[model samples]
Structure formats: structure tokens, C-alpha cells
Target chain A: MIKFSDKQLAIPKLMRPVYLVTAGQSKFDRAFPDKRTEELCIDALTQAAEMINVTPAELKSYIHTCYYGHFADHFGDQLLGEAVIHDRLGLDPLGNCGVKTGGATGGTTLWEGVKAVASGYSNCVLSMGWERMDEVPTDEGNFLISCAADKDWESPLGHIYTGYYAVMAQKYWKVFGKEEDSFRRTLAEIAVKHHGYARMNPYAQSPMKITIEDVLNSPVVAYPLRALDCCLMSVGAACAIICDEATAIKLTKNSPHKPLRIWVTAGSHTLRPADRRDMAIPLLPNETADQYKDLGKKFPGGERYPGFTGFLAARMAAYYAYNQVGIKDPTADLDVIELHDAFTISDVQTYEDIGIRPYGYGRDYVESGDCYHMNPKTGKPGKLPSNLSGGLIGCMHSVGATGIMQVFEIACHIWNRWAEIHGDDKLWKKFDRKKPADWTDLQVKGAKRALAISHAGVGSHVTATILMDPDKLIKKDA
Target chain B: MSMFGQVHVKNGQYKIKGDFHELTPNMPIRNSDDGWKLMGVTNPRDMTYIHSYGGESIFFESLSKGKLMATRCDNKKCESKGSIYQPFRIFCPDCLSKMTVIDMTDIAKKTAKIHTFMVCERSGAFNILKRPIKFINIEFDGVCTILMSYLAVGEPEIGMRVVPIFQKLDPTYTILDMAWVPEKTKSNHLPKGFSF
Candidate 1:
């Protein structure tokens, strides 16, 4: 069993308010043969500048330091890839550092930038992330990703990271899902919804109009997890500009939108799932101790706190973030969310971990159409629409860039510009993609707050980024 | 003639011999969609990496001898004292003291059962395991941690009884040297070179 002291569980605090002025990303795809990695990064940075109606040079004058997120050096075969990008961006002599925590690199990079501005170290900071997975073949890429696991014990089992992650899915399917056929269909529904959402996203990589049947019929990578249930291996770049209140005002002075208040908190767990010990479930603000007292009786083999089913990192991140931002209930308090849907099953797992739904009932979030941009059942806005950006499932999982892409997506919704950015005909033509005639606008009208979850490894690292309009503060001090 | 890389420690340092890498030529990648224009060059690399087992070498060494080793936290002051770790932790997690290595071969043979399992049909490059690997996480009676290994024979299911099998013949001196089989599996049904 494990325990936490009062100090360890104390809420995290920023010295001062930090705001996200603007964010942007390049078009994501499986491979970019004709373009260099720096070119993709420049595209992302240029978009960030244009979002604020400022020239690239004008934006550079506001940035005092930089944080870069590039997950795999071996994939690109460049050790100092950050230096290369920083040099190419022409931000010379600025103290810049690289942030890498597997898939959570993008969120953790923003976390660093937020701290810099909050601590009065720099007025404005730049946080950028990208990945270059197209450098190697798919099989070789899998082998390299497996190296993230315990090299001596786990990696050699099949030299595949999916095997390590699949064991948890197997357990969750049996314990929480109860191996029910209905639950299996619910998992398939997530794939259909994410892919459907991707159809409207011009920058998204795999915009398939798939169905539940297609997902079920797809080839199985691991039993109970088909190819359609997995995330894409993509190459792209994404970035955000974090600034203090004064700098945020200045950067967005001539722009149409005001800056959104931002807060990023993180948590971690053992890299190997085997190392997770039994413990009591860390209750979110919405949960009570009595709610899970008979979890084992309710669902047999579900007694272990996180044993293969839950992501302690995500739970703890939400724990710190909700308390820090004064979020009493996520489903009612937040307007929109973007979760790291690494797999369809893991997507449901996060709903429970982050308190979107109670443990063992995450399927209801999808079945009830609460996670949709437009509730199919009622044709009304969802109570809390999630992953409108297609998430990692239909969108890109370009490692370091994934979390920033999510932030960019939610910011578009809160800024009430989702349709303008996603439905632009020029962007579609520029990316060589066809705009479906039935393309629907997915903007959440009058959205004021949002959240995004960035995760890494089999729950080794996780970050929670919450963005809210300054006027809609839940707690006056927060 | 070039041979596979070999290394041995001498005078507290690595003494290496033979070839550790191979030279390969780069090839230009041409785009067929645009008049076969040159896009990029493929850099071919083939090399071997040397990894030391360090303090955990005993655990791997014992696998070939048909013994299952685990570490126990014996520090009296530690809150997690008396805990047995199957993955063989070099030190106690709660307290950083070196743990006591204990042979849990009998415990694993008698009380091991599958906690969860997966049947993976795909594998990454350089994988030596057979297709559709039956991956199982086995839990022993007294061990605090579950051990991740592959099933050498039979289908895997949750709560299924299993026993450890070691590659006593031509041991690989790695985690692959050990695998698990369902309880009461006949010796003839075992994979080549593996025995209970």
C-alpha cells in the first residue's frame, strides 16, 4: 500500500496569473517527405504569430525564453534537435531548454512556460513541440517506442509497447467492462465519433467516415483492440505563446480575442504497470469515500486501486488541477474538453480518471451522447462535448506535438473560432484535402472554459491544462 | 571475416572484440507522384548495443538454473518491510536500502496464477517470439508485484494456474530465458530448450 502526506497532496500554486495569448499547429500527416522538420516548425510558429495579427518578427520581440518539446532523438537521429529548431526560428541567444516526457511533452512544455511567466522570470515565453516519426519504418518505430518500457524485463517480451499496454486493457475489459458485448460496442462508438469529427478538421491526418462495424471488422493488433481502436503515428508541429497578464494584453492588443487564463498541473506513476501497488482511490472533488467502498462487490476483481485499469498519473493531475482551479465538478463546471484518446479504451478510462464520469460507468459518457459536439439523440449541444479536435484517435499522435494540438483546438472553441479555423476553404486546399460538402460547424457557442489531458507511456507522466475566460472565474482568488 | 560483437569485463573495464557495426550505403528517395523528383536520402544504420545487467545480473543468471529469484525488503525501519518483489528490485522502493535476494522458485511453481493476459498478433522489428504471443502477468501468493512474462504453451485466461519454465539449454542470459506454462503441462508439450 502507498500513502501521501498532507504536504504532498497540497494544492499547487502559481506566483501570479498566467494567460495563453495564442496557439497554432501545422497540418498533420503520416509522413512529410518533401518538407524538413524545421519547415513544419516554422509553419506552426508562423500560424501562432498570425493568430495574434502580428508579424513573426513582432512576435519574437515579446518572447524572452523558449521551451521545446521533441520526444524521440533517435527517431530523428538528431541529439540537439531543439537547438536546431531554435536556430532556425532565429531566436538566437535566448535561453531555451528541451522538455520530453513521451507523449506528454507538449503539455509539460507549456507547464514550464507558464511557470517562467508566473515567477516573473520572463514576461512572455514560447512553448513549441514536434515529432519526426517518419524517419524510420513502422516496425522499427515500434521497437524504438518499446525501449520506453523497462529494457531488462518488459521490452523483450515481444519488443512491442502495445503488449505492455494491452495487458491493462485486457484487465479493464474484464473487470470494469465485465466482458459485456454492449461495452465492446461502446468502445467501437468512440472510434466512429472521433473519425467523424476528424472529417471536419482540415489539419487532421486520418479523416475516415468509419462505422462501428468497420471498427469491429478492422484487423486486430491485440485481441479486443483493433487497428481502428489505436491512435495514428504522425509527423507534425504545434506551439503556444504563454505570457504574464501585461504581456498577454500587449500581444493581443490589436487582435479580436482576449487572452485565456491558463493553468497546467502534472502527476506521474511507475513506468512499468507491474510496479503499481495497491492503494485507496484518490477521490476527485466530485467523489465521496463511500461511493467506492464496495467497488469490488460491485465489480469483482476491481478492488485494486489502479491495478491495470486506472491511470494514477491522470487522476493525480486532475486532482491537483481541479483543486488549484477550484473545479467542483468537471461535467457541470467545464464547457468542453480534449482528452488524450491514445486508444478507444484508454479514452473511456480517462473519463473515469479525470472524473468526467464515475468509475465503471465511463461508457455512459459516450452512450448518452454527452461526449459529442452535437448530441445525436437530441440534436442539442452536449452537456460537455469532448475531443472535438478528433483527439489522438483520428487526429495525430505526433508525440511532442499532440498535447499542444489539443490546447490549440480547445482554445479555438473558447475563442468561438472553431468553424473559422476548421472550415476554412483555403486551409483545406492548401493541405491538398477535399472539403466534404456536408461539413458541419462544430463550434460550442458561448464557450467560456475548457480542459485538455496530455498523457505519456502507460501512465508514467500526465498533465492537465485548464483554460478559462478571465471573467468566468470559479473562485475569485484562483 | 567479420564476426558478431563480443565483450567481457577485464580489469574493471570492458574488453571488446570482433565487429560491432556494419557499413551500409545511403539511397536516394524519389517521389513517384512528382516526376520522380529526389526528396531525401535514406541513411542506413546497423549497429549493436552493449548493455550491462549490473546488480540485477543474479536474477537473469538464476533463470538458466531453473530458479525464480525475487527480492525482499528486510529493513526493519521501512514501512514496507517484509514485502517480496517478483521483478527483483535491487533496493527497497520506500527505503533505499539494498534488498535481500530470495529464491522463490517453489512459491512461483505452487502459487503462480495469471492476473491478466493479452494475445498480441503483431510484433515490432527484430522480435524473436512466435507470432500471436500469449502475454501474461503472473502473480504469486506472497509477492507484492506481478511479473510480466509470456506463456510458452496453451491459451491464457485470467486466474489460470501457471508454472515457470526456464531455458536450461542454450540460455540467452536474458528475460527470454524464462517463460510460463499452464499448471500440469507435460514436459513434451514445452517449447524447445525450455524445461520446468
Candidate 2:
């Protein structure tokens, strides 16, 4: 099973063989009005057990630790969510933890589990992410979510989260988008692609396809960002089981299905984006580069352009993940991706953040067909297959579970049966930007590597986890 | 976090601290001396903030009386030489020492210039804006920190000279009670002091 000898691998001491053994999510919906948080968690866990081809008791026995990630407090009355879940699961709670990192909660929980296994503290761990938003109305939900911003500074100023993203989108347009409604079209492409992609995903919420005109005509929730531009809030739960390399091998060897060796290589995060961090340079080109020749002579860290902190944070996370995985070119190196496209414009900014595309060209990149969903006739990826699970735009965002669900989708591709399982009759390729690639749909056909990225609360938190197909990666490296 | 894990609320056992009272706010809707003119109403989202930190309490008191108070870090080792801070800096950011309060309370508060701004086309908590509200980031003369406030009077231009216009209606107001606009008059100015 070990493809590389100890001498051939320059394995960093900080990194280890953390593998994703199984992943599962309860089908996301606009609002699961009747379902409770614990109910969703149980449903997802049951699905996960079924996918792993193990009974509930057997799977429960394999888990050494459990980490739960849930964001908002107003959603329910479970302050002790992890403890309550443990009691419900009838499992040992010795090394269990409840993690909350705003929206990065799931990614952080997964990271904590990875660390626990890597540190030899536990052999097998479970990360649970769930949120029920149907209990409350949109306004109250937005109000609760807004409370997560800088209360002393941004919140008291009546700053809404969408407003924050809107202003950034406007500036990004001013700098990168150039023409009047060109950026608008770019945002439409993202929404259209993701929604069309979701149509194929049975687990998605917004599987309906929309046009650039549809997005343009949609009610402007915030300037430049239409109702369609933002993702629909979801009610769902997702769970993933992580194990050490030995356990993963044993599980894979014993299974009747095909070999699925998914390695959790690296995970990166940027927690506090708004806090006192040094701004290396201004994001807006309005500020002349020469203005910072001796900027520290007056301003401490140069001009404080308080925008795109989340994007910057995501970029930082991607930088570290790439470094850990020894990747120089993300566009060529990675196969599939599931990023947080809570907003269409966010996905545009995300291309720049992930180093797949440069700054000011995220919209242009999509316009060039480098990341299109799929080509209908050829049944191949147009550019790169991103958000194949339809993403938050299609799959629905249940707050905490969104990130975990992204990871779950990546695992589906590595498992090989991703294509035959999800029937691809109706799709989201209504838009254009036809790029080149001959890979099949759903099955990221010869994909050796994949990444699932998530951002929490207006870029205040970001996590990038790179998972690789062990056999292909090791063979290629060897 | 220690306080949280220190058993703040275990098994839902906690002491009730106070009784609840009905809330009534001093709304901003203009009331014409009622019997003589028109009836007045209020903004339902009216909020009050008692900012009593880092020289903020005194700063608001001075702003109500129309004064532009700034503070300077007194530490000899301060990073920036004679750098000015507003809403008043309590400690020197560089050397971490107490700051020296300075009142640049000029009748010619006209020294400040507009840096950047955006028009809020959407209505939110601030009902004061019937139309799109114009907000600006003002850079005061010799001040190190930027001041974010509303523009009350005219269309703001970058580098436009402006001063504070204190609220005429609200008797109890914060720094936001006043807005930065073109320096049109000096009659409403209340000269407080030169230093604190």
C-alpha cells in the first residue's frame, strides 16, 4: 500500500497521513421546516454509514472522537451541542470537542480532528456540521449573522454583510470589471453555471438554471448583487469520518467496492481577518503605488483600505496549502474544486484568491471558459469542474454544514462511482465561455487531486483542504 | 473563555440580576409644536450608546459644544512624532504610554478635508436618511486617525473644506449628533477650551 519508500518522501514533520474514510450529507433544501438540528445530524450520519457500507453501530464503534460545528445561537437552544450529540449517539465523549469559527466552523472541526489523529491522540474521528435556518425568518436570520461582524466598529455603523460584499464587488468592478455592466454578466455566468450544475445534483436546492438577463432583472438585494447573486439559505447537515493511514488502508482493503484511498494532505485557515493585521499594499489601484514609497513614515502599515479582508484571508490559506502540498500551479495541478460561492461575485474573487487566476481577471477567467461546469454533447469538463455538487449556490448553505459538504463532494469524485450515481440529464450550461478539456462529467475522469475551499463570514475566516487520490499521486510523484 | 468554561451556567442554574422595563425612545420625526403646527413621531430603531472609554466621554461632551478634540501620545518614544488621534487616544500605540489630550477646537474647523465617500442608496438602521445618505471619511489637519461621519449639507468633494454641524433637534447626542459639511456659518459655534 505504501507507494513511496521512507527515503523517497521528504515528508514534513508537521504533516501526516490523515485520510477521509467516508463523507455524507443530508440533501439540502430551501428550508427543512419540520427537521431539527439533531434530526439533521442523525440523518446525515445515517447516510454516511450507508455510504461507508457499514451499520450504525459498526461505524459508531470506529469513531474515536467527534467534533461538531454549528454557527448561530438563535437557530436553536443547544449551547452544549457536542455534548448533547454525544448523548444522543450513545457514544463515549472523552476526546470530543465543539468548534465554532464563524462559518469556518466545519473546516476547523475537520482540522481539529485531523490534528487529533495526526498527534496520535485518536485513530478515527468524526466531524459533524449542521444548521437549521428554517426556524426563523430571513430578516432575523440576517440580523443574527450580522452580529458576527466587528460589533464595536462595523456593526454599529449599520453595516450589513451583503452590503459589505456589495461594496467590495463594486470596487472590484471599478478596478477589474472596467465597462459598465460587464461585471454583472460575469456574476451571472457564475450563478448560471452553479445553478445548472446543481440541476444534476439531487442533493441541491437551486437546481434551476438562470440567465445573465434573469440575474440582471432580479431584485437588487444590494447594489450590483441581485437576489439570484446571493445563495439561498439552507437547512441541512453533513458529516465526514477521518482516520489514520493504517485504519484507512484496513477499511479500503476490506470493502467490496473499488479502492478509494483519499488522503487529507493539508488544511489551511485565516481566522481573524479584520483584526490588526499589516496591509502590505492597497487593493484598489486608485491609490498610486508610489504613494507607499515611504508610507510607514506616517501610516503604520501603509494606507488601511478596509475591503476584501476575507479574500486576502482566503488567499493566505491557499498560499499555505499550496506550500504544504508542494504545488506551484493550482490550475494544472488540482482536478476538482468546491469553493464557497455564497455570492456569484465571491466565486469570481475566489478564482483570484485560490491562485488559479490573477487579481482583476477573475471575471475574465470565467468569460474565457477556464472553469465552466460541463459541455453537454461531449460530456466533458468545459474548463475546470468547480462546484460539481452545485455548490452553496445550488446545494443550499446550512451555515456550518456548507464547508463540510464541500469536502463531502470532493470525496465523491475520488470514490469513482460519482458519475453513474448522479444521473446527468438536466444541467446548468446555459451560459458560455467554452474552454478546452476532454474529461467526462461527474467522474472527474483521470483526476489525481482535488480541493474543497470554504470562507466564513465575509472573509473573516477561510479554510482550504487539499485531498489527493493516493495511488495516482504517489505513482506520479514516484 | 475561562469565565465560560468556569461554570457560568451549568444545568441552567443562574441568578436573575434585574427586572425588565418598557422602552420608549426620543424619536427624530419632526414635531411642529403640535398644538401650533404638526405632530412629531420617532425612528423605531432609535438607539443610545454611552461611549465612556479612551477619552470618548469627554470627546462627546466637547463635540456637543462644537469642539474638535484630538489627543497626542506623550511617550517620548512614540513612533510617530506629534501624531494626532481623535475620539481621543488613551494610550500611545507605539510606546504604550498615556496620551496628552489636545483641543484643536478652531472656529475654523475648516481645516479638515474629505478623503473618500460613498452614498448609501439603501435604507438601514439610520432612518435619518430619507433619500440616499452621503457618508465620508474625513482627514482632519495634522490628525493621524481618519474620522468617519455623515455629510449634512451639500454634495461633498474630495479635499472639500468642511466643519461639524451639531444636531439642532436632539438635546442628548453623541459625536454623530453633529455632521461634517461645508463651513457656511460660525454663529452656532460654542468655544469650549483649547486643551483638556
Candidate 3:
């Protein structure tokens, strides 16, 4: 059985290091129509084992904490779910429990794993997140997801997540949309780019490449939010094995798994969107009306209004994560990104929210094709290639699974440069556009720093994490 | 790569949105048996009510009688100075002082204007409403916080004065039984000096 024990590791200061030995995910596609939740859980777990050159059974003796993310306990037909899944995977002897926040469930679970390792709670923790959304019909699924909205205010009014975003899309168009329905064009363009990126990601759902023309013609689900502007309802799971420095060093010996020392440096979280005074102000609006008056005195901005729910939540997370990594500027300091694209408007707004661009300038950045991967030979791949694993849009959104999937893709891209398979020109030149490889441009351009941002929990919960390549961080220090 | 690296430690407090069932926007709420019926689906729901939510049963009772009620911090020492507003809460948000009820006897004549609004394709007692329901966030006279409701009438704009209209919903008459209408028209609940 996999085993390594030592004094608990301290974090951030790096007195004792913890590392992400490996990460994995099941096929991120709508292909698994009838898979059981346990089957999908196992599907992802076994793959995570394979990533580290071990079988699922070999992980039994060492797993200490089992953190699982499950957004739809109602849909899954099970309770005490983490216990049940851990039992099925034979990791039950360890303490296990589930944690969730509507959309940020996966990201939150990942943070739990980080705590387990950093807090000296566990040496090897299995962090998994999955959802069985494919079992339900589309309308029912939509309704179930709608339960994430404020049932009293948002749900009754049919201001479901899409509807919420659709209203934001309306305002965004009123502000930034280029021409007649230019906001629609921006969303169509984002869809085309992500679908194109998904083409190479083996685990992606709806990897079919589409043209802007096709996205433009698609039926609208919400005004301005066409069907393609949303994400896929895929049955998928993702897992990562985070271990302390002691276990990582031993495993890396004679193993293909490169220990990317737990380089994740920062994180942040906040409450529901409606708590904010106005939609435009990103963070919690303070709980009461009087508090907004105090907030106005404490943090002044002209005419605060709510724009999108998690803009400030995401901004705060990014701020904290950036601070952890000593990143001065996100657009310039970070190399790769995987952001939640619940809606194209959310994506465009996130560009400014996360400080990549100043507020109100997101439409310009998105329309410039700056988010797409530029060939390694041309502009710069590491110039912050985002959502390469197709993101929530092209990669498939299994709610709790999306955040972990983003982390998995970051690990994949970080290690892709060393994989040797894509080193050959013939195989590498297969696509002119950036596909799933460690796109040479990204690796060559360098810091190898990546950031993954997630927003969920009824449009308020958000988490931002910054990871550094152990080599890059070390080399720079030396 | 060397196996040595620093890991930092810090305790964190995460303020997540609390249980949302009760967090629905503070309103006099009542539910029906099946909400998903309008969505062309079978959803059997219970008649869940916040039950004089915020201990304001008297407030909802006032709405049916065409009276507007609010709460204010009664303590003179309290910084709020007895300013009144919808108390989906029991204590003062500013001073945490227990509040007393205030009846707006002229509630019927108080004018409210549309603040911001959205025309949702569906929203009603049941999830099945299909007629482009208009939900508006409105600012009422003498109220500090914005109130929300369906603008049962009018093409929406940022600032449009609208009058309040209430109808008795059978079985479970809640605040949702009231909606906003355009113009000052004759109504069963009409206040003094109100005319078309």
C-alpha cells in the first residue's frame, strides 16, 4: 500500500512542502448517459491512480482524508455520499465527508484537500468531485439547477442562473456590445474558440468545432444567451492526490509522476450575490440597507450597482491568490488560466473582475481574440492561454466536477512540456490552432504560473488559486 | 527538483451564503402545491410559507386590508432615530435594537417609482407562467430599502411612477397577492384623493 509518514508540513512559507503528485478526470463528455454515480467516481479515481503508476487498490492504506464535492445530492439519490463513495472505492477507513457550494463545489473541495495536506491532517488525501447530471431530462436538470437561485426572489421570478446571466448580458450589451446584437457575436465567438480548443482535449464534451456563423444561428435559451452560450450537462468526475513533501519525494523516485510541489499559494470565498447592495458592486453588498450607507463611507465608489453576482467575489479571490504568488499583475504575471465561463458575459466580465483588464474594457479584450491560444511560433502561448480543457462551456459542466477539471488541466499543461510525446514536429503541427498539447508557445514563454478561478454557490461563492512550477519558482529564487 | 519547499499555515473564515430556503428575498411568501406545472413538468411542491416570516404576520395582514406597515427602532438612544422600513428582520440592521411597528395610514396614496426591472419569460405562483412576466425592483416613498414585486402592468423603464394594487389570493393570502399597476386608477383598496 502507498505509505509515507513524517512531521506535518507547514505551508506558504514552505518550511515543509506539500505537492500535487498527480491529478486526473474521467471523460468530460455527454457520452456517459447511464453511468452510475459510483461508476463515474470510480472511473475518475482509477484514472488518478493510473496517473501515479498505481492501481486504485494500492491507495487504500495511506489515504487519510477523503474530500468529495457533490452539488446535487437530490439528483444522485444518496446521502452520506462521501462515506458511501469512499467505502465503494475502499478508502472508507479514512475520515471522509462531503462539502459543496452550488457551482464552486469542485473548487471548494480542492481547497479542502489543500487544508488536509497543509494543516498536517493527512499525508495523502484523495480529493474528488463529480455529479450524475445526465440521468435527468434537460428541463428537469434546468429546474434542479434553478434550485441554486434564491427560491424566494430569484427562482419564483424565473431568474435562474441563465436568466440571471441573461439580464447581465442585456446590461453588458447596453454597455459593451459592439453592433446590432454584438453581445451575441461576442458570445458566439467565445463558443467557437472554446469548442475549437475542446477538439484536442480527450475528456471534453461537445468537442465538435463550430463556426461563429453556426453559434449565431443557434436558438436562444435566454434572450441574448443562445443555447451554445451555456455549458454541457455531462456525467463526469475528477480527482487529485495531494501529499506532503515526504510522500512526494519518495514517489517521484523512479516514477514518471513529477511532483509539482503544492505550489498553490492563495484562495478566497464570499456569500450570495443578492447580499450585495447593487448588482454592479462585485462583493457582498453588506447584509442590510444601512450597511450599504456605511460601505459607501468606508469604500467609496460612484453609484454602486450590481453587475454580475460574483464579480467582486472572483476579484477578491484573485487578489488574495495573486498576493500569495507575489504576482503584481494578472495579465502579465500569470502564464495560463482556466476560468469559469458559466456564460459568455460572465467570462468577459471576469477579464476585468480578475484585474486582467480594467473594468469596462473587457469587451475590447474578448473581441481582440486575446483569450485564444496564439501559436508558440507567433505572439506568445504563455501569454495566458485560458480554458484549454474546454472550460465549463466546451469541457462539460458537471457542477462539482468543473473546478477539479480545471485544476487537472493546469497540471496537464504544466507537465506537458516534459511529456516528450509532443516534441516531434509532425505530431505537434497537426493543428494550426492551439489544441491540448503543452502548446509550445506557453511553455517557451515561461513563468509556468497558472491561475484557476471558479464562481458558484448560487452565484456568490468564488475561489482563485495560483500555482507555480516548482522548477520555475526554485530557479527564480536561485 | 529538490523536495524542499515552504508551506504556509493560516486559519481562514469563509462566509458562505446561509441556508437559502429562508434567504429568499424578504417578502410575505406563500407557496402552491405544484410549481413546475407551468414549465410543462410534474413537480409536486408543498405549500411552504415562511409563516409570518420575520415575525411580520401582522404586516401581511395589513397588506390585505390596504394598509402599509413597517418597523422602526423605537429606542431614542438608537442611532436610527426610529426610521421605518420593511422589517424582513426583527432587529435593527444598523443598531440591532428591537423594533416597533409603524402603520402608514396613508399607505394607499404613497407613490412608488420603478427602479430597475427585467421582463422574465416565466415567473408566478407556479413555475408555468408563460406571458413575459415583468419583475420590477421599486423604490417606495419613505422606504430606505428597495422593494421587489411583479409590475403587473406597463412597459418598464428605470424611473416610472406606479401605484400598488392588491388582490386576495385564495387559501393562502400572502404579500405576493399584491402587484403594482400603472397609473392611479380606481381600486377596491384606493386611498383618499386617488383618481385616474
Candidate 4:
């Protein structure tokens, strides 16, 4: 069995406080045939500046260095795309670097930006992420994505990434789900909810008013995972401006947006799922060792910790982020969350990994409707609303930009501009998307704290980004 | 007609011949709805990559000989000494010591069982696997990690016993050269070019 030293398991800490001054995202879609990737990136940066009542040039002045996230150099057919984008943004001669951690590229970019500010190296930093996936057809795109796997071993098997997740789904279905039809329907509910939430976000893609039945009947990509159950292959961009305390206050001087405190922590595992070794379940603050003593007995064949059914990288990321920010219980402490729902099953797996629910009971989080903006069972708000931005499922999996988009989404609610940004008819028309007649304001009222999980390949890399209103600090020192 | 690229290593250098890439003319992509306006051009590229298996070449070569080769950590100082790896590793992960290669054909035949499985209905471009691929993750009694492979016959279920089969004839000298079938599968039912 694998073991960890105290040093390896130590909680991560930043040297100083970092703040998210503002964030923005471009309209997400399957393909942006007319627009170039730089245009989408510029669109995101412009919106970020507008949110803070500043020009793009004004915001650019504050950025000392830049962190660009653009996964799949092969897809764009451009090596050193960051240099191209950096030159286009007119941020010439500044120290800049690119971050590529598969699906977690966006979050990893933010992690670097936050560190740069926290280390006192930069007063302010720009974290930008984008993906150009529409350059190739869907099947070729899938093949390219599969290259992220262990090329020699896993990629050649099917050249399809869905099959990798499908095996995990099959295991979870038998062990935790117990092969019940209701469990399958519960998975479908997540698709319905994310897609339903997409209807409210003007920038979101695949905004279908689909039902659980529609999801269940959708064409199967891999068994137990259908077309609707998968995340969209998208082209778009998202960006965040991270700054130190003084710079943050300076940048948001006249803006309505608040300088929310931000902390980004990351964790990683073996790229190949075959290499996963058994280990002791690292208990979160909300969990006790006694509660899981009977896990194997309760659910047969579920004895293994993080054996295909769980994301240990996500758990470790949350472990460090929670300790850093003093989050005792996510459901009770956090107001909103955006998980990397790369697939419907991965979404449920994340609920368990992040300690929103205990392991083996992730289905309850959805069945109880605690994940909804408004619980279907009750008219009251959910205990902790999740993925009101539609997540990757209904929105975009613009690889490099996905995690940044999630941060932008949660930031919107905390900034109290969700309705203003999402409901504006001008913004809707700007993207050439029709605003739904019944587009409801999904801003969580008085949201104080939020979390976003950005995950990569199987569970290779994951970053947990926590944003809390500075006034509502959970821990005084934090 | 141009021949496909071929490469061989001799004396620490690559000896290459034939065409490595086929160049095609770029075609303009126009929008018919917008008065046939020019939009973009298709850049078609076909290139073959030369990859070296290096230390693990023995594993691939063994597959064509109907042998299953695995690596075991023989480092006595290592914490995970004696742990066998199916997707053969050149060195022990725990101690970073070069491992010893051993044939595990009998062990796989007797102990291999599906740990988890998936049935994929579609595949990405350049995939040669048949439709409705029954992907299986097999675990052996003594193996610390699971091995991912495809089941050549019957539906897959967790805990179902399976045995390895090799593409001994016209082997591609890749991981695809190995597959698994049900424990009781008949020799005649095996896919062509594969043998027990």
C-alpha cells in the first residue's frame, strides 16, 4: 500500500493574502468559426475590465506578469500559443508563462497567478485561459483528447476518453449505486439540472430544457453515460485578475465588485488509472474514522479507497484548501460551488471527494436536492447550490478555460451581478444568443463563500479554488 | 504512389526511408449562406511518428510470441519489493530500482478477473478496435495495480474470470497485440490472428 509522510500531507499555505479583483468569460459554444481564439480571449478580458468599471488598458497596467492557460497545442496547431496571445494583448516584454494540466489548466493558471501575488513578486497578475477545439472535427478532437491518456497503453485501446470514465461508472454503478434504476435516474437528474441552469446563463452552451427521461434516452456514448451525460467540446475563453491586498483595493476603488479573498490549492495523481494503489482514506474535518469502518460491509466491493470510484486528487486538493481557509464543513460553511463535472458520474464522484457528502452517499446530495439552486423537494434555497453556471456539462469544457469559467461563475454570484450580467438583453444579443423568456436570476442571495474544483485526466491533476468575501472570513488569520 | 514511412535504429542512430508525410493541397472553406464568402482553409497533414519502446520493448516483443511478460521489483531495500507490474515498468516506483522481467502467462490465466469494465459504442478517429468495445480492467491476485485491456469475447462483468490472448499472427507490436476473453472461451471462438 502507498503511504505519505507528514511533510507530504501538510496543509498548503500562501505567504500572503491574494484577492480576486474581477473575472470574466466569453460566450461559450461548440465552435467559433468566425472569431479567432484571441478575439474570444480579448472579449473575456474586456468584460472583466467592464465589471470593474475600467478599460482593458487600465487593467492591463496592473498586471505585472501573466499566466496563460491553453491546453492542446496540437489542437490549435500552434506551439507557444501563449507568446502569440501575449503579443496580441499588447503585454509585450512582460514575464509570462503557460500552464497546461489537461482539464485543470485554467485552475492551475489561477494557482500560478495567486502564488505570484502571494509571493510579493507581483502586485497584480492576469490569469487567462482559452481553448480552440473547433479547429478539428469531433472525432479527431476526441482522438486528440485521448492523447492526454497514456498514449501507448490507454489511447490505442479505443482512442476515446469516454471509455476510461465508463469503467469507473461501471464500478460505481455496481458498488455504490447497487445497480438500482433509481440511481441511474439520479445521475440523469444532474444532467437535467445543469442543462436547466444553462438556460439562465447567456454565455452557456447546450441550454436544453431537457428532462431526466431525455437524458436517459440520449444516445449512449459509453454505457451508463449518454450524449447528454457528457460535457460539451467547446471553444471559448475565461479570465481572472488576481492581486495582492493593496493592489486589489486600488483596482476595485470605484467598481461595484468587491475584492474577494482567493486561495488556490492543487493536487495530482498518476496519469494512468492502472497505476492507482490502495491507500488509507484521508479523513476530512467533517469525517471521522469510525464512520467508515464498516464501508466494505455496508457496500460490498467498496473496500478500496479511491479505486476507480473516487478522485483522490480532488480529495487532496480540497483537503489542503479547506485547511488553508478553515472550512469545517463544505455544506454548512460554503454558500455556492462549481465542480468539474467532466461527466455526470465524475460530478457525483466529486461531491464525495470534496466532502459535500460522505463517501458512498453522493447520490443523496442530488436526491435530497441540496445541489439545486432551489431544492425541488422544498421551495427554500438549497443548503449549498452547485453549478448554477451550468457547469461543464451544460456549459463549455473549453479545457484551459473551463476552471476559470467556473471561478467567473461563482464570482458573479458573490459579486451580486449574476442577474445584471446574465439577464442583460444587450449582452445576450452581443453573443448572438436569444435570451430565454423565462430566464430566471440564479444569483444566490448574499453568497459569502464559494468553491470551484478544476480537474484533469481521470484524476491526474485537480485544483480547488476557494473565494470568500473578505468581510465574512471563516478564520481571522486566514 | 508513395510508400509508408519505415524506420530502424542501428548503432545509436535512426536509419529512415520512404515518405514520412503526405502533403495535400489546402482547400478554401466558404460559407454558402454568406454569398460564398471565404472563411478558412483546410490544412490536411498525414505524418507517421517514430516512437521508441526502449527498455519495455521486451514486453511488446513477448506478446507476439504468445507470452505475457511482467516486471517485478526485486530491490530488497524497497518498501514494495516483489510487487509485480503488468503494464510493465522499467523501474520500481517506490525505490526507482530497475525491475526484473518475468513471464506471468500462467498467473494471468489462473488469477485474472475483471475489476471493472465498460462497453464503448463509439471511438475516436484512427481507432481500429471493433464497435461496441468491451473494455475491461483485470486484476490478478498478487498484482498491486490493475491492467487495462479489451475483452475479445462475451459481455464483461465485475469479478468475471478472464484469460489473456495474444495476436501472434501479424502482431502490431503494440499493447493492442494483447487482449482477454472469458475463462471458458473456446479456442475456435477467438478473434482471427489471436491465439491462447
lDDT of each: 0.92, 0.64, 0.62, 0.93
Task: Output the number of the DockQ-best candidate.
Answer: 4
Candidate 3 docking class: incorrect
Candidate 2 lDDT over A1-478, as tens digits, reads 0022344333333345677887777767766534556777887888777776788788888888888888875565456776777777777755677877777777777877777877788888888888767655576566566667654334433344565566556545554565357667878878888887776676777776678788888876666677788887888889988888787766556453333333232222222222222344322212345644563344332234333322765765675566566666777777788888988878888887777765555765677676765544355565567888878887788878888998888777777657644543322221111211322356677666788777776777778777777765632331
| Model 1 regions lying over 4 Å from their true place | none
RMSD of 1: 0.9
Q: What lDDT tens digits, residue by residue, belong to model 4 across residues B1-196?
A: 7998999989999999999999899999999889999989898999999999989999999999999999999999998889998778899888999999999999999999999999999899999999899999999988888899999999999999999999999999999999999999999999999999
Writing each residue's lDDT as its tens digit, candidate 3 over B55-146 gives 66666776676565667767788655556664233566656776788775355246677654556653223454345666666665655555
Docking class of 1: high
Candidate 1 lDDT over B76-131, as tens digits, reads 99988999998989998888899999999999999999999999999988889998
Off by over 4 Å in 4: none
Candidate 3 versus truth, CA RMSD in Å, comes to: 13.0
Q: Which ten residues in a row have the lowest lDDT in candidate 3 chain A?
A: A1-10
User: What would the per-residue lDDT of candidate 3 be over residues A1-478, giving only the tens digit for each residue?
Assistant: 1111232111243334567877777766563533556788887887677666776776545578889999887656466667777778877567887988778888888777877788787888888998877655666567777777655435655534566666556555544443346656767888887877676555667776688888877776666677788777777888888888787766556456477754443233323332322332332111224433443343232134443322666765665455445666776666778988887778887887677765556665566656767733455453567887678888788888888888877776676642232233443353222344444332324436677876783347787765667776622431
Candidates' DockQ values?
0.81, 0.08, 0.08, 0.82
